[model samples]
Target chain A: MAARGKVYLIGAGPGAQDLITLRGARLLAQADVVLHDALVTDEMLELCPRAEKILVGKRCGQLSTAQQFINKQMIDNALKFPLVVRLKGGDPMLFGRADEELRALEEAGIEVEVVPGITTALAAAAASKQPLTKRGVARSVAFFTSSTAPEHAEHDAIPDTDTLVQYMGGREAIATAERLLAQGRHADTPVVVIENCSRPDQHIRRLTIASLAQGLGAAHGPVLVMLGDAMKTRAHQHNDEAQLPSAVQQLSA
Target chain B: MAARGKVYLIGAGPGAQDLITLRGARLLAQADVVLHDALVTDEMLELCPRAEKILVGKRCGQLSTAQQFINKQMIDNALKFPLVVRLKGGDPMLFGRADEELRALEEAGIEVEVVPGITTALAAAAASKQPLTKRGVARSVAFFTSSTAPEHAEHDAIPDTDTLVQYMGGREAIATAERLLAQGRHADTPVVVIENCSRPDQHIRRLTIASLAQGLGAAHGPVLVMLGDAMKTRAHQHNDEAQLPSAVQQLSA
Candidate 1:
């Protein structure tokens, strides 16, 4: 009998197909089957054309694959295939509910390797041409999201760090800004919102905490919110692309 | 005369050569001159062997390149070459003095692009097979370094976040543990120290905050310290590699 196939949990990186690590790209090409997240772009899936593709992520309204079912699929695929790939958007270590999947696979006694990908926060920082940490101005950076796990009760306390990057900052973007403001964060703290980062239609909105608390138009793609004084654009640098309006037209409720 | 060369600030992810982003590798191959940090591995430099390579990073006990001199080198090279690459260890935007270089380049009207790489924190998490953020236990993660800028007066406050990853945790690793313990963090909080993460000689040390406070043998390579409840190894998971002692022999001072 063939030994249980090893599973590779590879990060697809932020939106751009080529942003993935070379190791991730190589493993994807060799995979016998790939179970990917909703945010993994179709272009990324094309990297492994020979492999069977499964979408396990829950889109905004789409019926999402149950965690248990996805775990079962990985185990079942490992039994039948030589290489199994569990592809997640962004680095698998953060906000992806990777702990559950890793625990499930561990119980099954399947060998697994995690290939890191560029997380959205870093990509968002790159897109805005702003470093998340600046010399004396900022020294620490925190990555958090308002989205809570089904089993966990949400906490109101925000992380006290030098810089903040909120993933999945859709409806909660304004709420986050308000809470930070209430926590005495500067109202004029710079905020950079990047939607569909690294994609062809990527859009960047540069505003302030006070302006963000007032409101930001609805976004169609995944949104990442970065707030801190370090995000302030340097004087005399002419970055016109970030000043332009969002390419994705906002739909009214 | 050739148009002024655009500068690309590419991240050489972790310590591994294959960990670099595809975009970074592609640009690196097309570079006419590459100025890289001291931490970038020789294998990564092989990607741009055709291009002139310059070591511009500060190594301990060695005469280091001045920030202004490095900035001037990039500008001078950009004026002569079609493609100039300023390669940095890990992500350029994290602890690297990228802002100074970016400012200098911008002032000279040179086009610059930042390509994100997998930061050492994420790679350390991957090396240890521990997720930085968990559903209920850890909802936020902070990345900081003890090293400060030359001009900045150091502050004593540690970020108040669920999970903390400290870069360049050389002599300060124990000091960080002591500080965290003093700040009311549980002494039993799990800590994972990764030395030369993602490299062939990579080493992982797993212990508690109290144990870390006691002492850790000196590390020759870059050391990253991760501390949080989320770093706890799952009960059923039998990860033996992490249990193994340091791969690199510790030198007694």
Candidate 2:
């Protein structure tokens, strides 16, 4: 029998291959079988040369792999191989629906170790030159997702904080901003809409809360909306910085 | 003149050397000088073979490096070296006070590139086998700290959310819980206090909001307090896992 296989649940980080930790990379290199989400890039798969790569796509309620199916595959793979890796887009511990997978795995007597990765919010912040938490300016950071089952809408509303980072936030920016405005959020709070963070073709648009509530044009990739008074920066950075089309020329935070 | 050095604001990850990203490790190996925080381990320094390693320790309220001093050193080193790394404990974008350094560097015409790292909250969530955000259970997650200067106490109150992770939250656990309770956090919400996350000597304590409001004894390392309704579990998980004294013995999230 295959030595009572164990599972290593890994976070694939934002997107880049090198962005992954040496620990995560090492686990991928040794895994007998690897099951990854759609967000795990092709370049990352190149690192797992000998492993059988299975794509369990999870794109938040669209045409994606069912959570139940993913869980069963993980169990079956664990039984067949000594080292089974379940790699999620970001960290497996945050909004990754890991509870169901973890519970079923543990019930089947499969040991598990979680490998945390850099979340999308952290990556977007870095790519956009924004700080999630700054001294005196922004003290706390909150993360939310706009994609929620219809039944869970009430709980999915964005929370009030010094900074807000929203994942899968593409068409919901207007509604989210309005909700915050009703809750007394500043109308001039700086807003940053980033599409496809960390990847080569990244686009960032900066505006204010009032402008975001008005609406935005279509975007290219997965969207993350960042809003807070702390996001305001001088419109004209030094010439050495990128001269993006939608650059926000304001005072630095 | 030497090449105008750029600062690679790298996150060293929780406590483990292997947890640092491959990008961060590569930058360190190529750095001419590395200025790291107190939380960065000596093992990480060995990654920089020929580079100058300076410990700019920043333990909360302890005798550590001042921000202005660290900023000055970064600027000074950038003028002389080709690569200067500011190795932080977690992701430089989140609560890393990177804005100060980034602004100072940009003002002086020094270039900067940020390489995100896994934050301690993500590590604590993984180590305790808890998820930061759940589907129906938790729709959002927030991060804050309790070590605020007296003048900034007003914004220090806990924000209402499904999950809360507090950093540098040592003796102030009781106050933080009380503040949340006062803000209408359920008295029965689950609480997990982690000390020295992701390290071999890690310690964890499981309690309820009521008990946490009563306070905890002194701890060994830096503390991370996680509280929310989503954290409620069976209180005792299977024994096959690590046998830490206060380990959370329940199904993983």
Candidate 3:
């Protein structure tokens, strides 16, 4: 019998291919099989061409693989392959349903290791030149998502923290902004909506609670909403001219 | 005159040399000068052997480079070198004093870019096999630190979130636990203390809010405290044996 193979549950990081950790990249290169989420891009998969690729895609509002099926696939693959990888789009511990997968793997007696990756909140902050935590302004940050699985109940309540980051937040920005307003946050509390963070076509829009409540135009790709007083652009930032668009332009040139 | 150098404010990640992002590592390799924080390990510095390294050490209770001096150094290097890297310990956006440095660089007319890294909270969660956010049990997570600068007033109030991860929390974990207990959190709320996360000598201790209030034993390196129901190990995890030590032993063997 073949030696019991191990599984690596890795976070692929925000959209950029190179945003992945060197450790994760090295594991991907050595994996005999790779199961990746839907949000993971083709460029990222290029790092593991030798592996048998499986798409266990899970995205909001789209038909995708079941969590249980994904778990079973991981167990089956671990038995067959020397190395197996389950790659999630962002940090696996946050909103990634890592608990269910971990339990399943443990019950099957398959050794599993989790490799950390940069979460989108941090990536969005980097792209927009906004620090989620600003001294004397915002000290605590809460990351939450409005989307829930069919088996789970949806929560309309907002997180009670200094800064709030909402994943899959494109469609709910208006409602979230209104709720923040009702919660007594200042009308001018800064809000940043990032679409396709870290991707080549990433777009960042800077607004305030009041303006975001008016509405966000159509957003393509994954969207993240960051709202708080800490997100206000520095007094000397010269507006959004120097943010994502300029960075992309400079890098491309 | 030398071309104006752009400064990349990169997060060195949570101690492990391979944990740095591919983008960050690539930039470090091409950097002309690297100004790294005290928490950055020497193994990570080996990635950029060709670059001139400056240690802007800033550990708690230790004499270190002033924020202003560090900012000036980045600006000066940007004017002289083609690539300047201001390497930080974790994600630069979270509790990393990035605002002051960003402002200073902007004031000096130097371009700056922020690269996200795996924060200690996420790494600790992964190392302990505890998800910071769990379905139903935890919908939100907060990261904070009790170690405040001497010039700033400390906040006695704990953050209101489903899960809380405290950075530089070893010395004050007992005080923090007491505050949490007083704030109506259940005495049995699970807590995990991780020291030297992601490093070879990393250690993880699991306890409860009541037990944590009794005081944590002496810790040898940078410490992180994670407290919440979501941090509780799964019932099937068979105690802490499957957590870190066994993994280390297996890998070493």
lDDT of each: 0.82, 0.78, 0.84
Can you give the DockQ of every candidate in the order shown? 0.48, 0.48, 0.60
Ranking by lDDT: 3, 1, 2
* Candidate 3 chain A least-lDDT 10 residues: A238-247
User: Highest lDDT among the candidates is held by which one?
Assistant: 3
Measured by DockQ, the strongest candidate is 3
Which candidate do you rate higher for lDDT, 1 or 2?
1
lDDT of 2 by residue, A79-166 (tens): 8898899998878888788777777787777777788888888877777778888877888889888555555554455776789988
Candidate 3 lDDT over B1-253, as tens digits, reads 3479989999989988888998889888989999998899888899999999998856744333577678888999999998899999989999888888899988887878888999999888888889888877888888877647633424546777889988888888778888898889999999999899888788888889999899887889999999999987876664453345333444334
Model 1 chain A: weakest 10-residue lDDT segment is: A244-253
Q: What is the Cα-based lDDT of residue B237 in candidate 2?
A: 40
On the 0 to 100 scale, the lDDT of residue B12 in model 2 is 89
TM-score of each: 0.92, 0.91, 0.92
Per-model clash counts, in order, read: 0, 11, 0
Model 1: CA > 4 A from native: A60-65, A149-154, A240-253, B61-65, B147-155, B240-253
For candidate 2, lDDT tens digit of each residue in B118-183? 999988777777888876678788998754575565446777678998888778877777788788
